[model samples]
Structure formats: structure tokens, C-alpha cells
Target: MIYFDNGSTSFPKAPGVGEAMANLLATSAFNINRGGYAGAYRVADMVLDTRELVCQLLDWDDPKNVAFSGNITQSLNMLLKGYLKKGDHVVVSSLEHNAVMRPLNQLAELGVSFDAARAEVDGRLPIERVEALIRPETKMVVLTHASNVCGTVLPIEEAAALCRARGLHFVIDAAQTAGVLPLSMKKLGASAIAFTGHKGLLGPQGIGGMLISDDFAKELEPLISGGTGSVSDTEFMPAFLPDRFESGTMNLPGVAGLNAALQYVLKTGTAAIYEAEMALSGRFLAGARALPGVRIVGVDGLEGRVSTVSLDFTPAGLDNAAVAFRLDSEHGVMTRCGMHCAPRAHKTLGTFPQGTVRFAFGHTNTAEEVDICLAALTGMIKGS
Candidate 1:
């Protein structure tokens, strides 16, 4: 089976990911910072190491600024809820995922408003477009590093610089680009970045985090206040970097898997992985474009995109869902169809109401797999 739905969740997670989780689950049953025992200390060390590993991957200086959460959704919620107050304004891109839209939408009831800078048809957002949306009350600028629906890389650095110049905080949702792209807080000039482990990071689900700059971390409040295993004497939640945000028991097993996966990603290097996936994506795009009735979405080339490629088959009078079903059932090629949780993105791409079928490549996918998928798409079109 060819797995092409890496955008949803990566398949065949890094070699030791599962083993790492299983090892932690089987041998350790200790809660971090709960007690002064060998097992607890060991678990605490693992958690710290995982945070440091994530920091290293993102080129962050302080691991303590990395706060673990259940997923990027939770991280975004924490950031949005903590940072934004009523009567505050922010700017977002047209290609933002629902994760960003939903939370901000909920905040709108309380007076937070945001404007979406129109993204280019090719899925790139220009800094000028974003800057034009800024208002007097604009407190921040949030953008997706890459579009999950169309795989277009946004202008993160340029937009971040705009935010900095305007005295607004810049937050990036690196859901699609985290492990696949070389991310640096200094390079991107981002005040904060939210990431998930299951996708490009090649780790298990239920574990992800947000990396906030020192100053930004200080201003943000914890979404949930509980026993942070620190400052136990007082009922008040600890006001430290991570302890301030991490209020509940940590997901130790997930952190173990993330630790192992981070090691794998660092050792393998994102540059090599990105090169390979782009090669596959370019191959698939080249072959698919040759087939009649296949409409390639987003950028035509790999210059400003990741490995994901969305195809619209309606030109051939085929339903995107039906096409995806056949690709999985008959062609043994798995893919995700419909809006991919980014309805606004689909609308921006002119594939709204009826979304396109997405084929997202991963680190383990190859050119041969791309050929097979291209051939399968041809068969589907011809048979129709």
C-alpha cells in the first residue's frame, strides 16, 4: 500500500518511535516531578531531553520555553487564549488551517478580530499583503508556515519581519513544515511557533508543543492551571517558563517517542529528507500534468512548496471522493480527499464547496511510488 496522506498523519513513524513508547510504558510508571525517586527523576530527565531536542531542531536557545501539549490545536489554543485579550486585533493568511480559524473565531465573540491577507493563487503570501491588513489594534500576526491543503510555503521570514517592525508578535503554525523544513526562531523572526509530532516529526500522536521566545513566553498565560509539580507549597500555579504553561501531568510515553523521533530527524537531517520528498512530488506533478483531465493545484513546481500535491479530478467528471476511494481500493494508493480541514484554503484555491484530492509525500516515499500513483491516476481517468 502506498501511503500518500502524510499531511493528515505520517505513516511508518521513525524506526524507534513505537519501541521508545513501549519501553517507557513497560518499564516506567512514574509521574514526572511527582516524587523524589529514581524513576521520577529519570522520567523528568527524559522530558527535559525531549524539550531540548525539539529546541535543537528549531534552533531555539532555551528548551524551557518549549511547552508540551496534546497537539498543535491545544498549543494554538493556549497561545491565542493567553496572548489575545478583548478588543485586540490580529492578521492571518488566507491559507490558515481551521486550528487557527476556529480558536480565533471563538475569540471574536469576545471582541478579537482578524483580517486574512489574500494569498496568491499559487499559495504564497506576500509580506506587503499581510502588512496592508495591519490596523491600530493589531497585536499579532499568525500564519501557517506551509499550507496543509495545497503544500504552498508561505513567506514566514518576511511576514515575521513585518510583525517585528510593526511592534506586533508573530506566531507561526508549523504543522506541515516542522520536521520537513529547517526552522529557526532567529531565522524566521517568529515570536512563537506551534508544531505537532505525528506528521513531519515522525512521532506518535497525542504529543506536540509550542516554542515561544523568552519575552513571548513570559507574557502568555497557562490555559489550564493545576498541579505543575512545582511550587507545591502554594495553590498558585508556578510562574516559570515551562512550569507556568505545563499545568498537568506530562504525556511521558508520547514524549519518549518524540525524543527518539527527534534523534532520527536530527541524524537524518531535514535537508536530505526534503530533497527526496520534493523529488517525488516533482515527479508526481510532472507525470500527473501529462494526463488529461488532471488539474494540479497550488504551485506547479517545487520552488515554493513542500511535498504535498492536490489534484482536482472533477474536470474528468469524477467525484474527488470516488476517485480517492478507487485509488485506495483498486489502485492501492491511499490519499486524502475533500477540504483537508482547511475550507478557507480550498476557497482561496478556487476548489471550495468541492475540494480536491491530496497526495502528500513523506520521507520514506520514493520516485517509484510516484510512478505507480501516476499510472493509477491514468487508469482511473481512462476507465472513467
Candidate 2:
């Protein structure tokens, strides 16, 4: 089957991901940083190595600043819930996923307010527009590196600079762009970056985290207070970097899988993977745009986007769900329909309420698969 929903979660994960998980589960089930036994030390060491690998991939400075969680959503919640307090204000992009919007919404109920800068009809969020929405009480600016629905890459560097100049925390949701796009902490100047290992990192699910700057880490409170296996004498949480945010027994097996996946990504190189996926997506876009009823959303080219492409079947008087169903059932071409958990993104692309069919390419996908998908789409549109 041809999998085109990598934006949701990567399929056919890196060859070693499952192997590593199995190996860890079989060899050792010990928790990290919880004991003095040799098994515990070994697992803790591996976790630290994984943090260093993450730092390398994101060009972050200190590995200790990276905090692991079950998923990007968890990481985002930790940051949002910990950093923002009552009476604070925030600025967000119109294309942000519910991961960002939901947490902010919860905060709003507690008296926090947020403004959303509208994206261009084409899905670009201008830096000046974001600045215009900033208020004296605006404490942070949250941006998604790329829109999960349309794959429109935002100018994160400019936005980060604006936030830095205004002394507002710049938080980046790198859920869609982490493994596909090259990110540098030094270059973007972001205060925090939340990422998912399963999506673009080519890792298994249940492993993701956030990388925070020294300043952000210091001021941020812990989302959960429990045994970090450190400072046991006191009831309060540890004041250290990672242990401060990490509580209870960590996901050692998932971290092992992520370690294996990171090794694969580093060896293969993000630039090559991105180029290949974009090529496939570009071919798909070219064919889909030519079809009478298929309307491509957002940018049709690879200039400022990832490999995700959204299609509207309304022009052909076909149901979006039916189109996706045919692609999976009749053609063995898997695609995602509906809002993709990003309602705001759908609204920005003018496909809200009736979401579009999304085709997101992965590193393992090929031009041949793109051709097969185009042919399947051709037959579906013609038959309709």
C-alpha cells in the first residue's frame, strides 16, 4: 500500500525503530534515573545519548535542556501550562493546530487572552502582521514551523526575531517540520521548540519532547510533580534541567526506538529526505492540478513548503470522504481526510467544515508511488 498520511504519523518507520524497541524490552525493562543498579545506569546513559542526538538534529546547544514526553502534544502542554499564567497574553498564527490553540484556550478560561494573526490567502503569516497583534501583556508568540494541513512553511526566523526584540517568548511547534526541515536553535532564536519523533523523525510513536532555552527553562514550572529519582529528600520537584520537567518512570523503550531512528536520520541526512519528498509531492501536485475537479490547496510548488498536499473534491461534486475511501479501498493508496486535528488550518485554507483530502509524502515514498496515486486520482475523478 502507498501511505500518503505521513503528516499524521510516519508509516514504515525507520528499519531500526522497532528493532531497538524490541531489543530494549527484551534486554532491560529498568526505569531510568531511578536506581543504582547497572541496568538503570545503562538505560539512563542511552536516554542522555538520545538527547544529544536530538540536539544534533535541531542544532541545539545543550542536551540537558531537552525534555522527553509521550508526544508533542504533551510537550506543548507542559510548556504552555507551565509558562503562561493568569492575565498573560499570547499571539498565535491563524494556521496553528489545536495542539497550540487548545492549550491557549484552556489558559484563556483562566483569564489569559490571545490574538491570532491571519495568514495570507496563500497561507503565509507575515511577521509584520504578527507584530501588529502584539500587546503590552503579550508574553509569548506561538508559531507552527509549517502548517500541518497545507504545508505552508512560515518565516520562523523573522517571527523569532520579532519576539526576541519585544522580550516575548517565541515558542515553535515543530511537529510537522522537525525531520523534514533543517532547524537550528542559533538561527531561529526560538525560546522553545516542541517536536514529535514519530511523524518526521522516522521513529515509533509515544516519543517526543521540547527543547527550551536556558532562560525559558529557568522560569518554567513543572507540569507534573513526582519522583524524578533525584532530590528525594524534599517533597518539591528538582530544579535541574530535564529532571525538573520529567517525572515518574520515563519511556525507555520508546526513547531507544527514537535513538535508533535518529541515527538513521543523521546518516541519511534531512536535506536529501526533504528533496526527495518534495519531488514526489511536486509531481502529485502537477497532475492533481490538471484534473478537472481536483483543486490543490495552498502553494502548488516546493518553494516554501513541505511535501504535504491538500485536495478539494467539491468541484467534481464528490464527497471528500468518498474520494479518500476509494483511494484506500480500490487503489491501496492511503490518504487522510477531514480536518487533520487542525481546524484553524482548514479555516485558513477555506476548506473548513468540509475538510480536504491530504496527501503527505514521506522519505520512503517514491516517484513511482506518486505516479500510481496520480493515476488512481485520475480514474476516480473520471469515474465520478
Q: Which tens-of-lDDT digit does each residue in 91-132 have in candidate 1?
A: 999999999999999999999999999898778787889989
> How many residue pairs clash (N, CA or C atoms closer than 3 angstroms) in each of the candidate models, in the order given?
0, 0
TM-score of 1: 0.98
Q: Model 1 off-target regions past 4 Å?
A: none
Residue 28 lDDT (model 1):
91
Model 2, C-alpha of 12: deviation from truth (Å): 0.9
At residue 41, what lDDT does model 2 achieve? 90
TM-score for each candidate, following the candidate numbering: 0.98, 0.98
Q: Report how far off residue 342 is in candidate 2 (Å).
A: 1.2
